[model samples]
Target: MKVIQVMFDTLKRNALNAYEASDIQTPNFDRLQQKTVQFNQFFAGSLPCMPARRDMQTGRYNFLHRGWGPMEPFDDSMPELLKQNGIYTHLVTDHKHYWRDGGATYHPRYSSYELIRGQEGDSWKAKVDKDMNIDGLDNIPDEFKQRKIGSIAQDLYNREHMPKEEDHMLYRTVEAGMEFLRENKDADNWFLQIECFDPHEPFFVPEKYLNMYGVSQEEFNGWLMYSHDDYTSEKADQLKNFYKALVTMCDAYLGKVLDFMDEHNMWEDTMLIVNTDHGLLLGEHDWWGKNIMPVYNEIANIPFFIWYPDLGIQNESRNQLAQNIDVPATILEFFDIEIPEFMKGKSLRKVVESPGEVNHEAILFGYFGSNMNVADQEYIYMRAPMPGKEDYLYEYTLSPMRMNRRFTPEELQGAELDNSFAFTKGVSTLKMQTSDFMGKNYQRFGNKLFNYKEDPAQKSPLTDAEKEFEMIEKLKRLMEENEAPETLYTYYGLDQIHSVEDVRKEHEVLDREQEAVTEEITFVNYHVKDGYLTLINALKDKTKAQAMKQHVQETKAAVTEDDIRNWIKDNVDKEEQARLFYQLDMTLRVD
Candidate 1:
């Protein structure tokens, strides 16, 4: 038995010809529709890049407990499980994230893997081009410069080496995948994952592809930015064309896989699962990218196709509520391996065979710390944190690394041991508080409800009381099933806001107290014994400092503001210490 999973980073569903893509030329996808079971409503369980990949690898949702991070030590990785069952799992391609700090734990799960570099902000293939202005932040987008201010100058540096279409990462990644297939055509008992980080950002493709869509080579920049400061109707149209051209390029390479399958007659036995990590926004719903925005269909409803020889369900589309996590369970079941009890995903065998049977009433999906979204057949509910309730947020993880690096001392300072989640295999995890520190968007958009039947575009939010209640209940039930941390219930206001009256009261309280409620958070080192004197000297009221020093001396304790901060650190919980010291320091400045 064999399975080949072609995973793309941000392949939009609506950009595929099979998924009612009108303007985009995705004939390869259309051909795939004839050879595979096209999933019409497949959604992404976790969001962005690494979180979605974690869901695919672990067969469970990662966003519920943690944001972007490495795979947990206890994660039942799909490829590793397959290998344990006498199945050889091999990974190939240029998804540069697999080598990142957060996604580093995933590629190793496979029996053998090949990593091709130079995608997105991947620091690969350095070449000092004296002709190009490499040092300035002028070329970099503001999202890469300010709020998420950084430089993607590496991408341009990497591009300097790839001068031709064939030299591009996309081309090389697909070619490597095809080479793997060529080598393993006669071999069995192997699962191959060809992951490509293309059709994602910059929409960087060959000029030939752009020419097909009447776009010039110079017209495309990153095309997708997190900010809407430059969005216009004309810009949207231009960006859409660029995106379509890249998707077409993706289709061109995808056809190669189809051609290989057809040439070797591998479709008779081999299973092919073509899926994306998640979809890109492509200026839909007046948004440019996926971050800090609502997880609308453009970003959550991804492209998924499967062709299992035994199922014989080709050339048909299913309305099943499949998600990224389901890919692992489907592959396991195909090889007759038992799906782990820890996995929340169900096999798609029944989804394709059982018509008119709904597999999920509502599936939860979102970026962690952003929105907790629930989508059923009819509507989607995006629940944000209540005004004051957004103050508390945490990420429970065995792996303390963020998307690109290890957690700093400040982030790890307040971490506590938590042993509540059932999926953690009785192992305790570090409970780290975010506490308004992370640059990632949390509760940027308010609560929203969209009925698909009325607003397919999700432009207008609905105001149905009954529907909102039902969706909220379903979200709560799903969250409970997922064994979400108890703090999340409070942070999301699920434990508090039940009715309109509850909402009204919270809003009133928020309105009155929000003006005066400014909380400061930080960590203090007790080794700074002079902190006591520093605090005392900085105080406006010398008499009060003197009185406090005398009291501290009598009690055999420290007297400075820093000393008090350290004292709070040694006595009170770290969570409360920061706030207490902040208040004390604020008071010390008073005359």
Candidate 2:
């Protein structure tokens, strides 16, 4: 069987006319919808670029264990499995992340692959345009100037070389894919993945597409300018139009693929799957981009369509709730290969053949160290870490490479072998603390529950206590099924269903365990000694001691001179409260 999977990056569900009404035209997507089974409730299992791709390949979620990392050594990659089954797997993509430190392991799994450069911040060009000045570009903070300027400069160089619309990276990528299809159309036992990085960021499309939308050259910038500053409505509209123009260009590429299939009549034999990694946030919910905000429907719910030739299903819409994880399992089923026991995804063949079939109860998705979210088609629940509990998370992976750099010495200092999950194939691997790499807001969105039926935009957070409790319990059960780490449960303050520590001990590094215990004791002893020092320091500062006494009697305001003054005036018996206040002052300082 031959299959072609068209993976588009950051393609929103509402971009096509078949999905939702928009000023942007996607006639090709609409045309493909007629010949394919469109999925109505497809969500992204993991987030951003690489993590989502990992889920697509492994048929399991990646965010639960790691964020933005490469394929693990133990990953049951779909392409590799297909190769082992005597099927040729080829990949064509402009997603440059595949060449980075963390993504280097994925493309090698394929039988053959082609990477098209000059997408986003990809450093494909060296010439720095010293004279080009974009409007409002200087408003970017100085701290971000180097990276942003480098991207802008590289993009300027890339655009300079492409004089024609056909010379664009998206067009070239599609052309390469078409060439591959034309050459291998009659070949047996081959799968082709035509991955496009268009319509992602920097939404740079050809002038012809911009002309179709009546967007002038000067009005369009080749940068998305993912700034934290609030955007005016007019500016947001302009940015949206730019993205729409790029989508139109991407639609034309899809049309070219359809044209190839029609001309060759390949539809009778080839299975075609069209889907996006995840949706992009275009100023929705005040989010300028993805990864740093809540995984709302605008960003999490994605577009997915499939055409199975043997099944002979066409122009139908399926509402069976699916995710990116299902793609790998579906591919494995198409090739008649045995799905691995570690896979957590269900094959979409069942759901496609029978739309009424329920494939999943709840879909879990999130970025690492962010809110852990679950959705049941009607309601979406986001469980955030308790305040200051974000540190209680760890990343267990054999591969310690980061996005663009190797793990630092500090990051690996406490790393040790661990086999806390059943899917690890009885192999102990490096378990590193997430706090070593994940900084504050590592893509954080606080706890929230939303009923999409009422608030499709997810603007209003629901306060139903009973509903929240039910969702929390469901999330905990799912996490347990996924074999999530103990720290994950502790981080969210969820009741542990099983002892993850026992699982760790089953494959323990005895020396590391003892060292961990020793470190805990040392930490406690240091704190005790620090408390005495703080008390001595408090005794030496009578002004501070008096202020602390006054602070205890005042209204509950954080430490401030005004609050202390108010307490001093209100207290008539200062001597009686002095000792208690001194201890309180020492405790506050020590903590």
Candidate 3:
């Protein structure tokens, strides 16, 4: 039997809901859903695209690598295993990150792979221009350039004027998949992975789909405004409508692929699985995009579906907590292959045969970058580090009333003490004021407990009680069993350096040089006029002053006296004393 996995990027479960609620229809997906076993409780192992894709391909927890960028050289991914097993693996995607040199290692593991470029708005521009029969001109107006950039406005204009022809990436990807399916109908067993890069950022949909939802240009632009603060109730509704339209557009394409599969009778033998890497937040919790906050269910709880024509587990829904890590093991098990010992996920085939029999108690999630949200099922925890500092832990109940509302220090201190939260016991560190010493925020070992059954939305923290001890103990055991050793290969510093001695020598040289360099001195003078302290750069250059003003505007903070002094110290080698004086003058004006 052939296995075809069609993965859509950022396809939210709510998108399906919205399509059903509105006049916009997805006949293909709807029919496929009827024949497939829908998994309602599938969650993402990691987030923001790449990490989740790694989890799906590696069959391991993302935290094992500390949420680092791209795939490491030591990563034992599934595509390699599939290739070794003679399962002709292929990947067709437009995810820009996968094209990065450091990130392309995973792509090579596949027997065959294709990358479709043109992110932002340019993806549709070439096709639109070609369809419109536009001449090759040396220059174009800003308005025309903006349209070519794939802006929402330009897409609307295309629907009215050009209407996408046969040149869209979406159309190309679908056609390629359909053609492959037809050619491989009776060939050797294979695995085809098709990734669609749509319904992501810079939301744009054809007018055909927009018309189904009755969305207008005013409503679409108004929805864009809701991405930030100053949102209104009316604006929120319009944004919701616009987002719904985009989902419908995606669904329309999904239908096309499904119809092709059905026409070729591919579903009879193919193990068809439809799922997304992650989700998007459209005005949920006052946020419009993915990375601004934690992995709420709106984004984390993804849509997972599998269809096996010969299997009896059709038209069923399971709520057992499953994640992307299980995907590799599931595929392997389907082919009667043994799962590797290092794999972190169990085969879902058993659970599918005996629904409600599996006991998956808790799932762990972690975020590594600027936005961090770690949680189980009951309570959500956050750690937002100050610029150039270690993160401080903040606990919160997941209810809308408590989200983003700071907990008083007294309240945190007064909570009943218990061993519900895990604490990292093995670690020693010399604290540094600046995060530069550690390179990034140091990981703190801690434990968190949640009552998922009672509060699936994670609205409240578990209270300390004798009855909850078992649950806490089980969670700790799971965490310990799943934890993987961190090797030097995974560390950001070690990964960059050629050898251990190189890393040590680089640091040692810097440490020795630090003692001989003398600190530089500078001053800023502020004048009070009309009850306002106006600061001016003593070394005056109108252009430099304007540049500094622009910098302040962009960073949303004035260049303070300390900032200027640091700038001078860092760049003194380039301009000597002149750099110090100019920076000092700029500092006074910023203050």
Candidate 4:
């Protein structure tokens, strides 16, 4: 029972030929289509990157509980469970987020892991260049508002170390994955994951893959802003070419992976999975990137293909609605492991083998503190928050952090221990406040019901009275089933009484005695780094920079201009430090 899971980041559904985008070339995906069961209605869970990965690993949604953070102490990671059950799991990935503060707890679940660095602002390489001016670059984090088309400072610095096509991280990622399979392909009862961060923003492909989509190399901008733009249609087409070329590169690497499987003659007994976290909008819906817009068909609907050895279904497409959260259950069931009762996802082995078997009646997908979307076989409903609500979202997690760095002390100042979730292992987690609010953006794009069966493009908003009521009921039912926060029920104005029992009454774990920890040990490595990031961003303001530098010097901690992310990983990755900064941090700036 060998399983090889191949994951990609920001892979647009239309970029692959199997998903019926005639323009982009994906011969390897087309090849996989013949050897696997293509799921036409597969959707994404959570969002962006780490949230989706958490959902895939835990077989449950995380967006309702937390925004973005590491796997909790109570999380039931599939790979960890598999490893405990005598199955070996290995991870080889170039997704740089796995090493970040929010994603720090993921890769260790595998028996062993390998990471290929220098992808999308990873703090990998270090050097000082006199002429390395970043004023011309538009993709820096500080310039995200008007970010146009340029690589960030860190990515450019990392690129200096990679002058050849084979030097790229994606190439190295694939090569290392093959190296693993080369050593252990014959071994059974092992799971190998080969994940790549490609075709995402900063679409910096090797020169070989560019200019193949009829857009010349000179016209290719390797970056796209994460906001809506009025770029000329000509520039949009050029950007599309850039993305297509990157996808083609991904396809090429995928073909190499498939070639490895073919050359080894392992398909007869091995299971192959092709999946993505979620799709991105490439010049569609007047948007260029993701995370800030509605989770439309272009983004929520993802491309997934699975090849099961015993039940080999080839060149066939299934319309049953499934989401990425089901991957954990599918893999667990394949290994004959018991799916945890708390796992809400269904095992797709049955769904794939039998056409009449329904995977789910409805599934919810979106980010935390935003519009909650519901998609069934018939309709797609983007449920809006209340019109005048301030969102007032709280992230429930054992570790409080964001995608990259730790949350500020102010954000965690109001945290309270909560035990409302069913899968938290009876551990009360920190219920912290966040600044993610919903108003104009979330509500405006929502309340939109698209009859996907009649209007696949989602251009026309359907106004069916009966279907709207049905979907509203469906949303409430699914939300309650998922153990949604009480605020979420109010956000959608679905706070009607139902048969669901009171949570505190049903689960009285809170009344139990708290575990006591009284040991006190001297900590050696407790130095806090200075506010160098504040210093760097305030360079133009000499007065502010001087004040920040003085404050930093007063703190007497290690300071460096080397890497902000490295500094964060070293300084802010701890909960106590994040909370300490509330009192220690300077209020010299708007902060």
Query: Which residue pairs in candidate 2 collide?
Result: none
lDDT of 1 by residue, 1-591 (tens): 999998778898888768764888988888988998888888999887889888988888998888889999989998999999999988887877788788899989989988887777567865554233333233233333432222355666677688798998889988988988999899989898988888888667788888888887576555365432355787677778888888888889989999999999999889999999888766566556775567888888888888878877889888878788888998999999999889998888888776676778789999888789999988999987654565467788888887788889888997899999889999999998775432223432557889875788887888666677788788989999998888888888889768756655655665454223211212143223223433443444567556545545554332345546545455454444443443343233211
Number of the predicted model whose lDDT against the real structure is largest: 2
Candidate 1 similarity to native, TM-score: 0.82
Off by over 4 Å in 1: 127-151, 436-441, 499-591
> How good is model 2 by TM-score?
0.82
Question: Residue 468 CA error for candidate 1 (Å)?
Answer: 1.1
Q: For residues 1-591, could you state the per-residue lDDT of candidate 3 as single tens digits?
A: 678888877787866842234444655567767778888777777665766776787776654334334554445567777788878888877665566532555688889887765443333333434343222211232333335333444444433433363554565666677677777878867888877777665455555666676766544532142122334787666666666666666677778767776788777788888888888776665556664444567777789888765675677787777778889888887766677766777777766777766635656554433333333434433322222233322221211111113334544443332222111122221111111111221221112234545755544544443323343344335546665222212321222335435544644654454322211211132311100111122223556445543433354343355554453455334334343342233222221
Off by over 4 Å in 2: 128-144, 436-445, 496-591
Q: Lowest lDDT 10-mer window, candidate 3?
A: 527-536
Q: Write the per-residue lDDT of candidate 2 for residues 1-591, one digit (tens) a residue.
A: 899998789999888888999888999999999999999889999888999999999999999888788899889999999999999999999998999998999999999999998888687867644434545544343544566676666776777777787778998899989999889988889999999998898877788888887775567565665534447887787888888888998899999899999999999989999999889777676566776556789889889999999999999998878999999999999989999999999899989998779999888998887788999868999876644565778888888888887888988898888988888899898988776323333322345889987888888988665677777777988899888898888777565323444323422443353344233222223333333223323344577555544444353433343333344435425543344343323232211
Q: Could you give the C-alpha RMSD of every candidate to the true structure, in order shown?
A: 11.5, 11.2, 15.1, 14.1
Clashing pairs in 1: 144-150, 145-149, 146-149, 532-560, 535-561
Show how many residue pairs clash in every candidate, following the order shown: 5, 0, 6, 0
Q: Is candidate 1 or candidate 3 better by lDDT?
A: 1
The TM-score, computed over Cα atoms with residue i paired to residue i, of candidate 4 is 0.81
Cα lDDT of candidate 1 equals: 0.75
- Candidate 4 error regions (>4 Å): 129-151, 215-221, 437-440, 496-591
lDDT-wise, the better of 1 and 4 is: 1
